[model samples]
Target: MIIVVDALNRHLFSDILAEMHALRARVFADRLGWEVTVKNGMEIDEFDALNPAHVICLDDDGDVVGCMRLLQTTGPHMLADVFYDILDGEPPLRSSRIWEATRFCVDTEKLKGRTTRNSISYVTSEVMIGAFEYARDAGVLDAVAVIDPVMNRVMQRSRNAPYDYLGTPKQMGKVKAMAALMDCSEERIAGIRDFAGINHDVFGSDDEVLSLFKENNGSAGNGSREITLESAYDFAPEPEAVRKPTRKDLREYCEAQVASAANDEEKVAALALKLELAEILRGDVQNRCDA
Candidate 1:
């Protein structure tokens, strides 16, 4: 099966929306026996239009089989809107730098065999990589996912421990649980860089990291087995080496980041330090730029 990842833009919006509705109807109503009604032959809500979303399309002998939706946490998102009850209304979602990963569905009929689990794993990994790439480009520092316990375990094992959990799994339904937070640190970035080294042609360019963030946004948070990375330093650095940012460039980036934060005192304070570091870097750059 070939998987095509597309950004949720005007060109592909209608198709993705339709695909989303069909997948939801099949998974929720048919498979899980949920009581949700399918209207206008679509399943949608307010959150669907908010934030940028990515859609994953599967080609099974030229048929669209599986799909998912991923949204970045920019404004009122899943943490505050949908999963607030599970979080006890005290989760640190308000000022946290996180992406909300949700809305994952697959075509069971097309993938009904011993390799089903592995196929899901492979697709999930692709989605995750897409989500990470999106977050990085948008300057999102972290991600929060609400997933089923079983699927969480599968995700955790697939990554072989590439993430850290910020909260205990909150059981919401029979086979599901709500959890949040994942690692997207510089260390994790390094690991990905290394992975792409030997398999450069397979993973595409370095910028492909942004796509992972976009594609995986939906499934990033849903029910899955939890996995954690054993060590953050497992991967080697790029052969070309990373160049340090000039102080001016650093300062500009930091200021832009600071300005983007919401009116949260704690968030402002935390970002202030980052801004200071950028300022110092800027000073260094000034010295060099002037020289």
Candidate 2:
């Protein structure tokens, strides 16, 4: 399934983001031969500082397999800041309703199969569907993506071909790169789903996503399955169907987390997460209180 992660909830999905960063470093830097900053095994750039919303596809095993970054075109983006040269003499496209789609990559090494319209790869189509739906829901009407010729072809095969080109394709790094405009409408999303034959919701609900993460406590580097939160806080994860957590349950969970914190930083982080959790569990709390 795909997870839509923004700035507010990014801390909650730390494990997934870490895996995506590592994957980006592998795809953009190691394989694609792009000039990107890779620090501590993460492909992070100035745009990351802007806190763009990430549409990430996690495999059935809850491992990140595909990911894309979305940023508003009204603000600073790659095409405006860095790749403007590729635009040639044409003015940079900027609009409030438009967003820039970049870092569009998937776990090619793992998937191995060449992602194409003919290839029924769940992760590939799922990521595209996730991205377009995310943009359309946020009132974004279109997106500009900087892609290589090969990816452009793949995009065409997927039945979501670019409607316009910013400029002629120019060589960048080891391949040719150009900007292509993509419409973010229901029609576009539907066409992609039609090609992939996926007709269901690709995203899980907010609570469902959080519960899944709580079940996965593996650290960033090591793959060892350690119950990070459960051990640190001393409680089983919130069962999906059992019952929603009450305000008291949330408070106790926060207390346990803060109490087990090794230092002030962790304590602060835990409390911040607690406040967020309090908001999420408010309805559950109110119901229990009324009972």
Q: Give the per-residue lDDT digits (tens) of candidate 2, residues 86-158.
A: 8885555655578999998888787776444223366778899999998888888899999988888888998
TM values, all candidates: 0.57, 0.71
Q: Across residues 47-144, which tens digit of lDDT does each residue of candidate 1 receive?
A: 55443464454432323445555565435565555555666544335333666767666666665562532354444444455556556666677777
lDDT of 1 at 25: 71
Residue 195 local lDDT, model 1:
37
- Candidate RMSDs in Å, in order, are 16.0, 17.2
State the lDDT at 182 in candidate 2.
91
lDDT of each: 0.51, 0.75
